[model samples]
Target chain A: MDTFAKLQILSGAARYDVSCASSGSKREAPSCGTGNTSSSGICHSWADDGRCISLLKILLSNDCIYDCAYCVNRSTNPMERASFTAREVIEITLDFYRRNYIEGLFLSSAVMQSPDYTMESMVRVAEALRTEEQFGGYIHLKIIPGCSSELVRKAGLYADRISVNIELPSQASLQRLAPQKHKNAILEPMALIGREISTSLVERKVSRRAPQFAPAGQSTQMIIGASPENDFQILRLSQGLYKKMNLKRVYYSAYVPVTADNRLPVLASPPLLREHRLYQADWLLRFYGFSAEEILSEDAPHLDESFDPKTAWALRHPEFFPVEINRADFATLLRVPGIGVLSAKRIIAARRFSLITYEGMKKIGVVLKRAKYFITCSGRSFEKPDQPPALIRQQLLLSENREALVSAPSKQLVLPGFFA
Target chain B: MNQYLYDGTADGLLSAIAWILEEEPDPEKVMLRERMDTLFEEGFTIGTDATLAESLFFRLKQFAPDAAHTLYSFMLAEKEGMETSLLHYVSLAFKHGDQVKGYLTHPAVRDIVYIAKKAGRELHRMKGLLRFEKLRDGAYLAKMAPDYNIIHPLADYFSRRLRAQHWFIYDVKRRTAVRWNNGSLQFGTIEQFTTPAFSEDEKKVQALWQAFFKTIAIPERKNPRLQKSNMPMKYWKYLVEKQGE
Candidate 1:
């Protein structure tokens, strides 16, 4: 295939992997390199799907040896297959980076030949980009499951971030949906990358010249709604991963059905609202100091459709509400529905000069519609989460942007990959 | 009533604010020269005095260092009442001294911060949105017409990132450009700017990028409203991906 046709197919095949962050690395251009990465990643473009395009995300090859039923590139699936030579990949990356089209390359592939062969192909591309071109931009490499530890370690040396998608939440689901992928095969590399990252950080502290191994750390993704895992199970697994594996991020890609498989559940569309809620709950876990259990119990395994996880929590725990905004600690302010990390900091700082009123909250960019119910400026409530909890739920539901999020009908899209 | 006018430059505005705060007795009585009848009020034309501007900025740094950046970014806003609003902000900064930034709720400080945020956001966006096409002469040329005067802020960033490559970032709206020659940077006006033929590979790669952009979006989750919010229509004029959209 020509470069244009190859790019369309490879990038289309890779669109389902939605880890677009090119952040957490501050690699500067070496001598006369083409590009560099910012600590806060830059989004070069927004796709029609509203997802940020930070890197030139593409699969190295769509030809696979494994038959994973959920994947577009399953071996049994009838599709036009193609692969880019290392030189072709390098040329495209350098050209794109030079034109300021992408921060770097996010290179992945289906199992081409075998795990080791696939990883070696990816490593060659990254190694060439770093050594030959002296390119210092962000590079995220996906480690093929069952790859040797030596190749896994080599990948960490060149990649800013490395990942091995768990693909399914549980071992039972993995066995049923993806027969080739095993739980231990995925977690072993994840654990190896995590150790290498920590060791590299510690070594660099002793000597600035130590080799950086995935300085941005390791992250993984679990395809939600692909298997029968509930939010509670998925979130609990994420929390465990964050604690044990020292994972930086756990992306939850809403499973978009591509094939008619007896194992997979039929859905009208991707559960995007559920995916959005998972992201919101994920934020609560990562930043807002909420455990998975606190956000949702086994009984109430799903997030509320109307209210966000934060507001739902605020309503659940009314005692936490009516906290005085002026004196609320940083932790307290974080729990409030409308107050984010930035606005909470502003509230604290602004109060040191003068007491904040309800009007001042709006001026400081606080979303008062939700916050008014949960907070008070100075011992006086702006809008009370009054007697009946049901009434409060109704009011909160009315405040949300319903049309854009919930009710906006998903149109039938003519997919480019649908041609294959 | 007292009136003061400056050349609308950052330094000129700083000098005027310094003079008003230091020499003028009543800060509230001061108004812009073009904003009032100078025939009745005492009007002072504050020239672009670099010495006064530097001295005042030095003082502002001692009290609140970030306030200097806030003022500089807000000066690039070019809003209708930008000058008058900044005057109030400067007054608050001087009055509050070290504690100026903490008063986010104060009207004067709040308005200035909002303007500063907008300018800062534009500067960050322009850093990514600005596209460079390779020229036949082996130099890169990118053109932009940003909402704020962010061409100056971009100098240090691109200077280090694309240090080896000779490039020119042109601000077409302002009729000015920042030229980067290897490591050195030059900021000046080019009355009429034109580019010779682009390099042979530019069109091929542009086409490849446009294809990649379309192919990457998931068909199941197409949201043009969300796309427009992130990459606004205002920016679609120059983007290669949005050529046909």
Candidate 2:
């Protein structure tokens, strides 16, 4: 098949893996290269699905030996299959990079013949791009599970970021859906990559010219709603991965049903709301100084879909309310609803000169509607004094509906703030 | 009332600010603007003085380098009534010294920072949005009509990223282009130029990208509002993937 025909099938096959970030490592373009990686990945275009096309995220081939029930490109599925040669992949990437079509290439492949062989073909592309072509653009390679440690090390040396997908949350799910894959096969490579990353950091600190190893670090993805894993269990697993594995990001792909399988639960649509809530909880765990247990417990295994995770937490804990905007420290200010990391820092800095009032807080980037119940300005409460938490929650819910109605006409999907 | 008019450039504006600093012009009695016909009874037009502008630029840099850069970026934006905003911001910086950095609460400083951020955001977006097509002359050509004078600022970035290639970015709206060849960039107007015919291979590659873009969107997760928010409709005319679709 031609390269264009191959790209159509491979990119369609790779759409299920929704790790679209390209902004971890800042690799400067070498003298002979045609591209460079920036400190913050630029989203050149947004697909109709609202996902950023930062990298040319495509698989090398769609033919596979193992069948995973949730995946669209499983061996059992009847679909057009194609593969590109190593040189063909290199040429496509360089041509695309020169035209600014992508930041770099995201190369993944199926378990073709064997894990080692499939991984070797992917690495050959990266090696040629880095060594022969002197290409310094960002390349994210997916490490096939159970691949050799030697192959993983070489892949790390060439690629900016590497990811090993923990496809199923638990081992039972793995056994039920994908019996060929196991938990250890995935975790072992993750552990090896984590060790290599830390060691390389130390070496680079000692000598300015030490060779970097996967400078963008490693990330993993887990399919949500595929198994019976609750939000609590998922959060716990992600917390462990973040703490132990030192993963850069843990992407949660809402399980989109493709094939008819008895082991998988029947769903009319992908669990998008649940996936969004999980992302909020993940943000809380990563940035808002909230622990996994704090965000979700065994009893409350689900996130509140009516409101965001942070506001839900704020409603549950009333003792934390009425944080003085002027006197509160940075950490205390961060806990208030609608006060994000950036706005929290801005408040701390702006308050150094004068006391921050409720009006002043709005100008400092605080979302006043949600924060009104949780904060006080100059010892004066923005909301009525001594209000019941249940009443406040009811009021907030009502206001949320009204807010949604007001914003629905415009249908404004608030873009992520550019302050960062 | 006295009105001070000058050429609409960063250096010219800085020279006006320098004169204002020495004159202590009152906000209500004095007005500063770009060169335009005024109906006022008395007005003074300041000519570009290289020496005074250079001295003032160095003085502002010595006071706060970041503030100077922010002012430069703000000047790049193509907006009206920015002369007064720039005057207020620069005067605030001179008064507060380095404290102006955190004074986002100040109205004048906030206005200037917001305008500067708009320009910065556009520059960053063009890094990804700018597309080039191979021409018959073996030179790559990209076209854009940005809302800011970002070509000069963006030249440094493309020089480092694509140092070995010969490419030119034409600002269709401004009727000017910046060309880079042999590791050097030259800015000039291409008054009689026409869009070159793209090579067959370049056309094929463009079609492939558009096909990939169409196939990549998940039907279940279609959110045009969100997509439109990230990439506004105004930028779609020049995008290869969005063209003819």
Candidate 3:
């Protein structure tokens, strides 16, 4: 097939994979190589839903052997299937790279003939790019399940990063949803790659010429709201993946029901807001020093839809409230209801020179309306902490209502104070 | 009364403002002159002092480390009322001693901040969204003339990643280019440069990217308004990956 026809089929199939980020890999141009890899964040184009589309994201083929019910390109689906020759794919990638259209290639494939066959095609694409085209750009190859450990290792050598999609969170869900794919097939390859990356890093430390093995580390995606798996189970799986396998990211894709099967939820659209909340909660776990267990309990299997994960956490842990801004550490200050990373850093830097006053908190860019009840600056409380949580919530809600009213007809409300 | 050539550039204008303040000249009598002929009979021509300009730049940097970039970006934008606004803020800074954060909330400074922030956000968003297309001669070409001096900041990220490929990011507004070939980058002007043709294979790939971009849009969730909000129409001409005839 021509490149355009191939892209239509491959991109349509690959859209389901929510691991399009070209970050974490820091490959610079070799002295003799034709391309370079950026250490800073990759240039990302956003889809309508704000998802990053930085790489030339596409699958090698959509012709699958397995029939995963939730997938649009499943074996059962009546969709046009197209596969690119390794040469064709390499040409397209280099062409895109030369035009400044994409930072790199995110190549994946379905089980075209077999798992080995699919993985071999994917590997060939990377090898051709790296060796023949001398493409030094970022390459993220998807490791098909049940592929040999050696082929997986070869993939790591050529690609900057690699992933094996843990499509479902639990073994039971995998059995029900994707009967053809087994849990062991996916997890075993991930385990092998994890070991290979660790060993390669060790070898690199000892020897100069050790081959780089997925320097960006591996990431996996789990389709949320697909099975009976709760947030607790999802978080537990993520926590284990991070702890045991040392995965860089665990992407949670909200299930967008494609099939009319009674087995799946008949939702018209994906629960995008829920997925957004999960990402926010995930950020808290990774960066904000919050544990997965601390984020959600058995009873609270879902995040609060109205407030962000950090704010919700602060609201729940009221005992940790009124954290003295003057004395609180970076972590503690970061935990306060309305303070962001920038504000936290500013407060830390500014406090070294002078004792931060309540007025200084405003200058430091703290959203005081939300943070007022949760912090004290230089022993001054704008709003006493003794107020009931319900009252505070009501007051905050009222302010939001007033702000909404003022901002609704912005042109009509010409007064500057309306926006303020 | 002293009327000086403030060189029209940021440093020159700032130096003139400094000289007026230092010389204790009458505000009503003081007038800015670009040429010697513009000076009146009573006007004494004082040239822009490079040393004074450098000192003011240093002091501004020390006072507002982050604000310096914002100030420079605003100046480059050539926005109206910027000189008076900058003068007011600088005079305020003299009294308040780096309490300029308070002035940021003031209406005049707030307006400047708002413009700077808006321009900064747009530049940042474009950093990811800006798409380049391959030309006939193997050079990857993308054109952008951002409101801020974002080309330099974005060059490091692009050059490091696309080191193997020869590429150029042309700023249409400044008529300058940040070109990288064989892993080395340099800046140069490309005045009235013509658009280059793409190779046959490159043209085929551009067609593929356009097709992919079109097909990926979930029809049910197709919101042109939102798309325009993120990738504004103003940027469409230079974004080679964007669909066009």
Candidate 4:
């Protein structure tokens, strides 16, 4: 098949894995290099699904040896299969990069021949780009399971970021869908990468010339709604990964059904709303000073679809409400539903000059509609000071319903990616 | 009522602001403008005084070093009434000392920050959105018609990223080009510069990029409004994927 035909099949296969961040590392152009990675990644274009297309995300090959039930390119599935030679991939990436069409290349592949062999091919492409072509653009390489330790190490040297997908939420689900895959095969490489990244950091401190290893850090994705794992379970796993794996991000991909499978749940649509709520909870864990326990407890395993995770938490913990905007600290103000990181910082900064009034709060870009009940500006509350939590919930729900009607004429708006 | 006008440049504007603040003109009645007779024929248009501009620029650096970029980007905003708003902001800063950054809730300071944020956001987006094509002579050329006078910002950005290559980013609307020749960067205006013919290799790659762009769109969830919001249609004319329409 021709290059375009190979791209069609490979990129089509890769579309289901949706982690499009090309940020977090700062790689300047080498002496004669043609490109550089910016401190904050740039989105070259937005696809029709509203997802930011920051990289040329394509699979090296879609021809799989082991069948993963949730994947479109399963071994048993009947589909057109193709793979690109390393040179073709390099040419496409350089061409696209020179025209400023992508931030970099996100290269992945199936378990062709074997995991080690597939990984070697992917690493060869990255090595040639960095060493031979002197391409310094951001590269995100997917670590194939059961790959050799040496191959994995070499990938980190060239790639700005690397990820090994923990496809299913739990091991039991993995066994049922992809019996050939084992949890140890996935976690071993993750553990190895984590160790090398830490070692590289320590070595670089002693010697500034020491080569960096995946400077943007490692990230992984879990297929949501494919298994019976609840939101609470997912949050707990994400917390564990952040704490243990030293992960920069944990992507949540809402499972889109492509094949008829007995083990999977048949749904009319992808669980995009649930996926969005999980992302909000995920953001709370990463940015806001909220633990998985605080965001979702054993009693409430699921996030409320009508309200955001932050607002839901505020409603549940009414004692924290009515935080005085002028006197409240940054952490306290961050808990208020409408007060984001930016507005919270604004409040702290603006307060030094003068006391923030209700109008000032609005001018500072605080969303009073959601924050009014939770915050007080200059000791004046928008709602009654002694309002009941249940009543406040009802009022907020009514307003939210009205706003939904105004914003989404028919259905809920599906934002492109999670944990944006 | 007193009005002050200066040559439309960052240095000239800062110098004019310093002069107004030092003279203690009545803030309510005083207005500032670029050297545009069409907009303000009656206002006193101050000529570019390099000494005053340099002194004021240095003074600002000494006073609130962190806010120099903010002030410069705010001046780049092409919004109406922005000059007067920025003047009031600078006047307030001089009165309040370097602590002016803390007044985010203050009306004048808030307006300045908002304008700066808008300009900064556009510059960030254009870093990726700007497209370049190789010419017959192997020099790369790109064109932009940004809402703000962001050619300077784009030039500084690409200079660091494309140091080894010869390239130029031309602001078509402003009729100015920021060119990077090998390693050195020079900014100048060019009248009636024609678009160069694309090399054969460049044309082939452009076609491949267009094909990938076309195939990348997911038909299941086609949100044109979202697409337009992120990648505005105003920039579509220069893009290879959107060409030949």
Give the better candidate number (2 or 3) by TM-score: 2
Clashes of each: 0, 0, 8, 0
Worst 10 residues of 2 chain A by lDDT: A411-420
Two-chain complex of model 3, DockQ on C-alpha atoms against the true structure = 0.31
Higher-DockQ candidate among 1 and 4?
1
**Candidate 4 on A247-298: residue-level lDDT in tens?**
9888887888988999899988888778888888888898888999998889
TM-score of chain A of 2: 0.96
Candidate 2: fraction of native contacts reproduced:
0.75
How many Å off is the CA of A142 in candidate 2?
0.6
Tens digits of per-residue lDDT, candidate 1, B1-245, equal: 66677776667777888888888777755775433434665666777788999998888877767887787778778665556667777877777765676687777787888888899998888877889899988898988889898888887788877867898898889998889995788999999776779999889999999999999999988898777877889998889888875
True contacts kept of each: 0.79, 0.75, 0.42, 0.66
In candidate 3, what are the lDDT values of residues A37-141, reduced to their tens digit? Answer: 655545545454434467888888888898887888788878788888887788777766656567789898889889998898889889888877777888899
Off by over 4 Å in 1: A401-420, B1-3, B24-41, B94-99
DockQ for each of the predicted structures, in order? 0.70, 0.68, 0.31, 0.62
Index of the highest-DockQ prediction: 1
Give candidate 1's root-mean-square deviation (CA, Å): 3.8
Assess each prediction's global lDDT (C-alpha) against the native. 0.84, 0.85, 0.73, 0.84
Worst 10 residues of 4 chain A by lDDT: A410-419
Per-residue alpha-carbon lDDT of model 3 for B40-100, expressed as tens digits? 5344445667888788767778876666666655664556545545655555555455545
State the DockQ, from 0 to 1, for candidate 1: 0.70
Off by over 4 Å in 2: A406-420, B1-7, B22-31, B35-39, B42-47, B97-99
lDDT of 2 by residue, A363-413 (tens): 666778888888888889978977888988999999978977878633212
